[model samples]
Target: MARFICGADRHQVTLLPNRLDDYVSEDNPVRVVDLFVDELDLTALGFASMMPAATGRPGYHPATLLKLYLYGYVNQVTSSRRLEREAGRNVELMWLTGRLAPDFKTIADFRRDNGPAIQAASRQFVVLCRQLGLLAGGVVALDGSRFKAVNTRDRNFTPAAVRRRIEQIEASIARYLAALDTADRQEDEVAHVRKVRIAERLDALRTRMRELQAMESLVEAAPDRQISLTDPDARAMATRGKGTGMVGYNVQAVVDTEHHLIVAHEVTNVGHDRTQLAHMSRQGQVATGHEALSVLADRGYFSGEEIL
Candidate 1:
């Protein structure tokens, strides 16, 4: 309580409460999110649950959820759990959602069940950006990023990884069999317990080997010579770090250089950016509504087939 420009007392109550609108300025981006989503027709955009069913309880309005979704996307708060947390405490979100905080499950379910509608909305946003002269430049840059999937490293298998794992298991089984033989020669209860443990380990290893054998057939049959058990669409992609990789999809984006707004995007299981030149260029042309769009990318995107 030192008198260095003291703040209001913790327990002090004011007769006139501050409004949420007072905290947000006129040019704040949340207003744009509200306006943009308000102008959309949810039913025409393919959003589900636009009309409430007669038998169920009322849910959050599609416009409210859409505003929340757009705010999260524009600010890079894409995780449903994080969005849920922000809705409770963040002033901008409080204003955007009208103080309604949907749970993480509701937010996640909305995203999961509305993929097509989300895509449709995104396309419309790009159109708006173009009409607003935000996408004035005919030049765009192309890039790709690998987004990690739910699949873990151990559950993902390449043909080479499968071979290496089988070899390691074979080695482990040999070592276990030698130890079991040594245990059999011992004339004590401790040795008997050791043999039983060794037997169990061998059984587990054999079972794992059999599972890998079945997986090997699938891996070989795959066009990419790899298989991800948890997320089948994910593929192993090499990152910039040497000998480092992740199981995920490659997201390609064509972004306008002037405003840095993404004009077009596509997600694929392909790992590299080499063959994406022509396709992304065409997409950029379509999105910007310009026939002579120039595309720029790094050396990794250089491919004779794609350029030709």
Candidate 2:
């Protein structure tokens, strides 16, 4: 018989032959993630639970969760649930976190509670990048991209959108009323069934109209005359495609064209890019440790007020 490749027996057992570090290659990006997070001062950066509680069960350290968060950022795994799963299964993550797998809620709460601290940590990372000469180009491309928020279009109310919704409800109510009139002119039994259904639909339309009217006041009071029920901080912004719109945040990034790495970024509820030019350029300059930087941007960044 011809020899064929063979596999180890399923029943075969051996001593712990491989260390966690052995599974992670030396040049893996997780090595950088591990090193960077170790150098951060969580307490000074405002992360909570740096010290163990006087009386309670122990919790995961801020640094561990922060490392996991950074790993997700680099790998593009934004969901906490996904991170938890990866920590339990992925070899690189297991090595990075030292085989400790905190649940998804813990991971999520860590991020939620340490927002400002994380921002400070991010600035520190930019400083480190500058030291490494990653920002040596001294020139950056400034642009804004709309990031979709948790809010849905149905839950978001723009002044014009809500007005249209209210008008639609009124139209539906009018049509239902006309149908009810026509139903009344029919035979008694047929009219009774038709009237009952029409009445129910009319009530629904009336209630919807009242709700939209109430939301109109809130939308009007907003700076942009828009209100999102799910995510109040998000705004309705038009995307790149024609007639396409989304209720989301505007993510402004300044990237060094040579390296194609983001030098600095800001998230805002502002929909337009017109006013963010000078502000983002200043951030890039500071991050790169330069007095000023050469900036290139599309016409979207042009603003008369921001120029001066």
Candidate 3:
């Protein structure tokens, strides 16, 4: 007989222990991690720590960092802090890193320290594509997009322009300081607030100008890795649209004509696409070992010498 108000019906069924060992096996993203370790030579590539030591424990393996980065890239969680968080929760990341979750600092340091290694890894994928017959004739599309940078727009400066700006800001600051002194002497609170505000604005301008100056110095000192407080190495580039420009790097890719697979790729801190056509075509020739290849790109990539 059914109860008049069926509110008391309850049941507790015993659940079996299902370890992750069964579902998550060798044929997974973890396999990519293992392949990276076995195929690539981290030591030769200038990786900091490749082998585990006696006294000190080994650092996170390149495979782990690679997997972490790959996962982060796929998920658009490029930030190390966000990747660290994802590592703990994402099942795929858990398997890739072998249930280990390194902190954000470790993750970020891995990228900062092993920029060359990561670039090599990306190149290796192209090699793999070629080997798999996925890249027959290496012709690629080249384009660039602006990913957000840590630097503010104000931090950017040209050497000559920045000097003039700094001089002007300093003059303004001096004037504001003098005005503040005069207002204090005359017991004028309203003028004092105005002067203080002006001083604050001047201070901000000075800070930004100083940062720009330092960046200019770095640009002269080390052309590569010169920090752009907004986005280090991110060039001010134009987009593909009719009249759109974006502040970003030029990303190049070599696509195979046969299989349409990318055989080579490079990221450049260049604003114009005119120069990239020949460079990328040369890279495609090298990667494919072909004398000639057909390349199709937008008008932006067109050049007289490049066509030749």
- Compare the candidates by lDDT and give the number of the best one: 1
Q: What would the per-residue lDDT of candidate 2 be over residues 1-308, giving only the tens digit for each residue? A: 25988887889987764677887888999999999999888889999999898898989989999999999999999999999999999999999999999999999999999999999999898888888888898889999888899999999998889988888888888899999999988988978998999999998888888888889988889887888889989888887797689889999999988888888999999999998998998998888877868999999988888776
lDDT of 1 by residue, 1-308 (tens): 57678878889987764788887889999999989898988899999888898887789987888888889998999999999999999999999888999999999999999999989999999999999999989999999988999998888999988999999999999999999999999999999999999999999999999999999999999887988989999999888798688889999999999999999999999999898899989999999999888898999899999999
Per-residue alpha-carbon lDDT of candidate 3 for residues 1-308, written as tens digits (9 for 90 to 100): 57666554367566644665555667776566556556877677667667667687567876678778877765678889999898898777776777899999999898998898777776777777667777664455555434544455455544544567678877877887787677677656787687778778877877877876676677667554334556766644445695454455656776776776666777777766688888887887877767877677788778898777
TM-score of each: 0.96, 0.92, 0.69
Higher-lDDT candidate among 2 and 3? 2
How does candidate 1 fare on TM-score? 0.96
Q: What would you estimate as the lDDT of candidate 1?
A: 0.92
RMSD of 2: 2.4
Supply every candidate's count of residue pairs whose N, Cα or C atoms clash at under 3 angstroms.
0, 0, 4
Worst 10 residues of 2 by lDDT: 14-23
**Model 1: residues with Cα > 4 Å off, grouped in runs:** 1-7, 15-18
